[model samples]
Structures are given as C-alpha cells and as structure tokens.
Target: MIMKATGIVRRIDDLGRVVIPKEIRRTMRIREGDPLEIYTDREGEVILKKYSPIGELSEFANEYAESLQQATGHVVCISDKDNIIAVVGASKKEYMGKKIGKELEKIIEEKKTIMVDQNADGKIFNILEEQEGDSSYLSQVIAPIVSQGDTIGSVVLLSKESQVKMGDVEKKLAETAANFLGKQMEQ
Candidate 1:
C-alpha cells in the first residue's frame, strides 16, 4: 500500500468528530451521505475506504462476467460506480480493478444503455481513463445497473473483432445482465 501524506491534520472535537478535508473528499468522490469503512492496523494507522454496495458481490460478478463472455463470445466487464470489479475474456488483465472513464461514469449517472460500433458514428470510448488512446475494442454495449432507484454500477459487452457488430441482441444482453445484478442487490 502506497501512502502519501497530505500534510494536513485535524483535531477531534468533544463530540469525536474530525472533519475530512474537502480536497480529499472530492478526490475520493465521497459525497455527503456516502458510507465509509474505517480500519485500524496494528501499526497504529487508520484507513478510510469508500464503501461500495456492489463491491460486496465481487464473486457473483465474476461468475456473471464469465457467463456473459461465453454467451456473447466477447469481453464482459462488471463495474461498480468507481472501478471495474470483474472482467472476463482476453482483456481481463488490462481492465480488472481499473477506474472507469468519465464517459462510462456519465452513462451510469444517466442510467441509460448505449451501443457503439463502426457504423454508429464510430465514437469509441476508453473503458479506463488511463487507456485514453489505447482502446482496443471495436464494438461495445453498456448498460447501467440501477438498484432501488439508485444507479450503482454497469455491465458492458465489448468485442475486439471488427466483424462483430454490436446490435440489439448485445444491447439486450447487457441490459438483462445489469438488471439481474441490480435485482440481486435489492435482496
């Protein structure tokens, strides 16, 4: 674990509350009501991690991604709001655990489904911001997972082959997977 000291400190009040700096909150994407997991190590260090409900289903997501990859013959990625949690297919190593790009974040925020292919304006988007100019997929379908009226994650189908045109079938499959995952969260 690489830790960087921000050179900022705060003292706890009588109520046992120490305000987290605004800069850190923004950088970590921690909103007002977001849940945070606090951990203390034997080394006397305290760690705060943003909690993601979808992250609790990591194993289930991996199985879902594998099944989707087999059924669609393409790469399948299941991501929480901030990072790709599960990925299956040849590009799994490249995308797994990576922070998703801004475009995908917008899609999830909008709670919409989108398909991109050679014939559909050719607007290829990076799955990860770090992969800005290195996107290898020729087609993609993205669907947002909305649980209990809250958009939590997404399911994506990606193909590297130029001949694999993503159409209604792929769109529906992604949407179905996203819906299934969302329903799982409800339980």
Candidate 2:
C-alpha cells in the first residue's frame, strides 16, 4: 500500500538538516523528539521513515540471542514482559508471542537475574516443557531487563545440552544482555 505523496521540499541547511512541514509532521504524529529513519533505494531515492524503537530493540534481541548462543552453545530467550520476543537454539516458532507468566513476572518485579541448574520443563524460565509434544528447554538463565530503574522485561538463556552451571562469567554476560536491552529501550 502506498501513501499519496504530499511532496513538500525544503532545502537542507548548512548544518545538514531538512525541515519536514508541519502539516505532514502533524499527520504522521512526528513529535519534536521522535526519530526518523533514512533509507536509500538502489535507484538513488531517499526515504525518511518514522522509527519505531520498540521494534528495533526486539530485532536487536534476535542478534543478542545468536551471539550469546555462540558463546555458550546454548538456547537463549529474550522477552518483553508479556511476550516471548526472541529465542535462539530452540524451536521458538511455537513459543513466540506466548505470555511469560508468573515466573517471569517475579523476575521483572524483583529486577534480578536467576540461574536455574535443572528443570524437567522450563517452567521457571516461563517456557513450556512441551509445545506440540516437544520439550521447550530444560535449564536456563533468567535475567531481568531493568530500564531507568524499572524492570521492563527479561532475557533467558537455556542450556541445550546438560544442565548449565551459571558461573560469574555467564551471569555477567546474561545480565549484560538484559542491561544492553535496557539501555536501548531508554534511547
């Protein structure tokens, strides 16, 4: 679906900024501090799109899961309070958009990271033991995403093999992922 072009143009100032007209800004709900994403097509056309930082952070969580998986060769889960935002090294297809439930709610409330050594199912991580008759995960690390002094979400790293001993390094890395997400959400 294409939006009809209003086509109002303003010359870029010496400081390299072009003003978007008030009418367009008002229509787009572009507030003073709202971010705009600039993109260029192969045909050399420039497009300025409104940025949704929440979507960006969720995508960033995907990368965060992959990197953490490489480090520990484990399953990693990223969540945004009510939703399972991203997961790596596990069958996340069925888990995506699922509620985090009571366990994760506690994590957010306390704003603390937890290291689970064993579980028949990932109940403590707020993951289901079975989805379509398959196990979700057994053991995991649960970290709270704290932003601006409030717990907003969680990052959970699950063990793919045996139960993982969440050491200081692992704990720090898990916390770092949560903290990094917190910082991004702040921006």
Candidate 3:
C-alpha cells in the first residue's frame, strides 16, 4: 500500500544490509518478524512487498461458504477491506469486486458485528437494503475479521426468510470465520 512519488535510495553494507525507514515500515505494517517477498520484474527491478496470505484466505472462505450453503440457505460473501473476494450460495456476480460502500465499511470502522434486520432503521439498514436491491433478504449479518486488533476484512451472511431466526448463530459463524482467517494470517 506504500507508494512513492520519487525513489529513495539506501546503500547496502558489506553484510548486504539496508534499513527500511521506520515511517515506511510503520505505514506498510511491516513488523519485525514479518516476511518480505523479493522479486524482479521484466525490467529486472527488484520489488519488495510485505508477504500476504490473501490467496489462501480467499480459497478457505469460498470453501467454508460452500460448506455452509446447505445449512444456512443464504448467500455468503467474504470481503477484504475493499472488495468481495469470495462468495457462495446466491449468484450475485455483481457483488464480486464491488467496493463495499460506507454501509458495511462501518463494521470495519467500528470493529464489531452488526445486524440489519427487516425492522431496523438508519444508515446501516438503508445501505444494506440498497446494496442488496431492496431488502430481498430478511436479514444481514456482518462481522469484522480482526487481526492483531485491526479489522482486515469481513464475513457477510444474508438470510432469506423472516420466519427464520439465526441472529446468534450467524454472528458466531462470522466470528468463527474471522478466527479462522486470523490463524491463517499468523502463519
């Protein structure tokens, strides 16, 4: 996530050592024990990046959602801070890569689980209904994936029937997913 307008250079010592500025490291969330990936592009320029397990998490979320499809009978979506990276159940192709608007972004901002039931009102409810196309789902549950105390993503489950009551179960499922992803991130 770090971008540079101009290059900053550093000299490598005899031991092949170069220090990344503390500010840059902080901005990139590059902790001391974190691994970095080094690679060369077609032009042979070296690129350094904080290693991420996004691919693995995406696959895991997809598989998890698929497994829960029968029991939940709802559309399950997994999203990073900005995008829908995985989904199961209903075919909302439109959901993929959709920039999660301010509505769900609040979950990450507040770092909490939120429910937008049919009778709910306010920004969250309005946004949920608008995003899902007019309250087609009877309820929505969104839980933030907290990694090292920061919300990195979210798990969203939408249920279809008013008669079905799964408030606690859906919340727990989201928490389960977040814990699962958090463990994966630690590796």
- Over the stretch 151-182, how does candidate 3's per-residue lDDT look in tens digits? 66788887778687557887887778777776
The segments of candidate 2 whose C-alpha lies over 4 angstroms from its true place after superposition are 1-56, 119-125, 128-136
Question: TM-scores, in order shown?
Answer: 0.91, 0.62, 0.66
lDDT of 1 by residue, 1-187 (tens): 8889999999989999889999999888777877889999999999999888899999999999999999999989899988999998966678888898888889898999999885566787777868775457788899999999998899988888977798999999999999999999999
Which candidate has the highest lDDT of all? 1
| TM-score leaderboard ranking | 1, 3, 2
lDDT, candidate 3, equals: 0.70
TM-score of the candidate numbered 3? 0.66
TM-score of 1: 0.91
* Candidate 2 per-residue lDDT over residues 1-187, each given as its tens digit: 3657677768999999889899988656466766679988897878888664444587788988899989988778787655678888877776676765665667767987877665443343555323342244556678888877866678887764554555677788899998898898898
Q: Model 3: how far is 18 from its true place, Å?
A: 17
- Quantify how close model 2 is to the true structure by its C-alpha RMSD in Å: 9.3
Comparing 1 with 2 on lDDT, the higher-scoring candidate is 1
Worst 10 residues of 1 by lDDT: 127-136
Candidate number that wins on TM-score, 1 or 3: 1
Q: Give the Å shift of residue 8 in candidate 2.
A: 44
* Candidate 2 residue 168 C-alpha distance from true site, Å: 1.8
RMSD of each: 1.7, 9.3, 5.8
- 2 or 3, greater by TM-score: 3
